[model samples]
Target: MRIYGPNGTTLGAPTGNTRRAGASGFALPDAIATPETRAAATPKAAGNIDALLAMQGIEDPLERRKRSVQRGRGALDVLDDLKIGLLSGNFDASTVNRLRDAAASLKSTSGDPGLDAVLSEIELRVEVELAKAGQF
Candidate 1:
């Protein structure tokens, strides 16, 4: 294919599989091991477990309630997406799995009785859908 320069001049005609000079030709030094790179490459054991325990240990009631509300809303959004996918006949096992996972993560209460009722109803609907799809 013809390659043009900035001024619309034809630079060169290169065919497919042509490799430009200086591309992928550089190598890192053998002695370039750094603590930061080593740490990044290594997996930290108990990191996620510690974080989950810390979250559960949170002392603020309002913070916990907020997190619950956010989770409930997220599950609701997943249900909405599932509804759309079902209507369009474009859903798959992954979509159903997402809905199930979201529903499972949601709390039954969010410090608001009305919202909790709505979330419970949504969760029931999700369960029904999963049952109908043979996923339950």
Candidate 2:
């Protein structure tokens, strides 16, 4: 295969001529690690751990509600799939396994009473289905 250069010109053989530069005004800042800077930049392990613990303690109620809703929806979808599979006599063990997993995820409280109630209902349905499948 032949190579082509810009403007669709066929590439020719390379030449030996070369160019060199003498000087440039650019100068790098001193980046050497000194003891003073090292001490200043070093992170406090205790403070970092405390901050991480604090962050973990903070939970947004809306986010929790959203997560619970998603879990409920996933359980409903699996239930629908299970129903379809049963009706069609094409049931698979993996769908039962997924229903079990969805059941586990539904146990977390969403910090909202109505959402928690709905999720509880979904969880109950999942449990019923799992029981019928002999996997509970």
Candidate 3:
């Protein structure tokens, strides 16, 4: 059992003094650093610009075929439109302009001989139509 002092006498007094725990005799080794130290340790970034440019330069055969198909289809569609316009007696010069643009796109080779041959045939039809319209 314990007894307490008067409340007024112990009101502002501290409970006890604190002390650091003593070392246990075990110590950790210091870290060893490399002799070569960098003044500014900046991270190096990969050169993606060159890689992206190289990728852009590479042409895909499938993609080329697809583009050729689209161009051929587009030219045929324009020819159909021109025929409809002429038969309806409402022919427009803009149709001829679109035909001209299609003709330009059809000149590129698709790398596949079969596709190129088909595209050439379509190109010939476009030229004939252009000549008839006096826009060749």
Candidate 4:
């Protein structure tokens, strides 16, 4: 299985042929999705408009960042779920491609001036996140 970072970049394949650490010694696929493991996998935050628009109800700079990151997290989660469905015979090729295109567009048009200003710096991360959820 392919796991992606919060920004949507491929996080390399699961250590192929390697076993994950376990209580007794090691485990494989089953060990990968244990409740503890999943619980520990926190989603990363993205964007930072709240600070730029402090008068718009978002007072705390950190809170603004947290909200933006949460949004990104939601999009990534959607993408991951859709990816699974598509790979599992739920989506036809044409639909998949269409969704991919849509995702690309969303990624390009996040509509946040702060992000747009730093387009050079944030494009990759934005695209990756949006692409993951077909929100581009």
lDDT of each: 0.68, 0.79, 0.81, 0.50
The regions of model 4 sitting more than 4 angstroms off are 1-58, 92-136
Model 1 off-target regions past 4 Å? 1-58
For candidate 4, give the lDDT: 0.50
Model 1: lDDT equals 0.68
**Candidate 2 C-alpha lDDT tens digits along 29-104:** 3345332211234443566788898899998988888888898999999999999999999999999999989999
TM-scores of the candidates are 0.50, 0.63, 0.64, 0.30
Q: Flag the better candidate by TM-score, 2 or 3.
A: 3
lDDT of 3 by residue, 32-89 (tens): 5223332654556677788988999998999988989999999999999999999899
- Ranking 1 against 2 by lDDT, winner: 2
Sort by lDDT, best first: what order? 3, 2, 1, 4
State which candidate, 1 or 3, has the greater TM-score.
Answer: 3
The list of candidate 2 runs beyond 4 A from truth reads 1-48
The positional error of residue 133 in candidate 3, measured at the CA in angstroms, is 1.4
Top model number, lDDT:
3
Tell me which residue pairs clash in candidate 1. Answer: none
Put down candidate 1 lDDT per residue, 61-116, tens digits, no spaces. 57767877787778778878878888898876787888789778764567667767
Lowest summed lDDT across 10 adjacent residues in model 2 is found at: 13-22
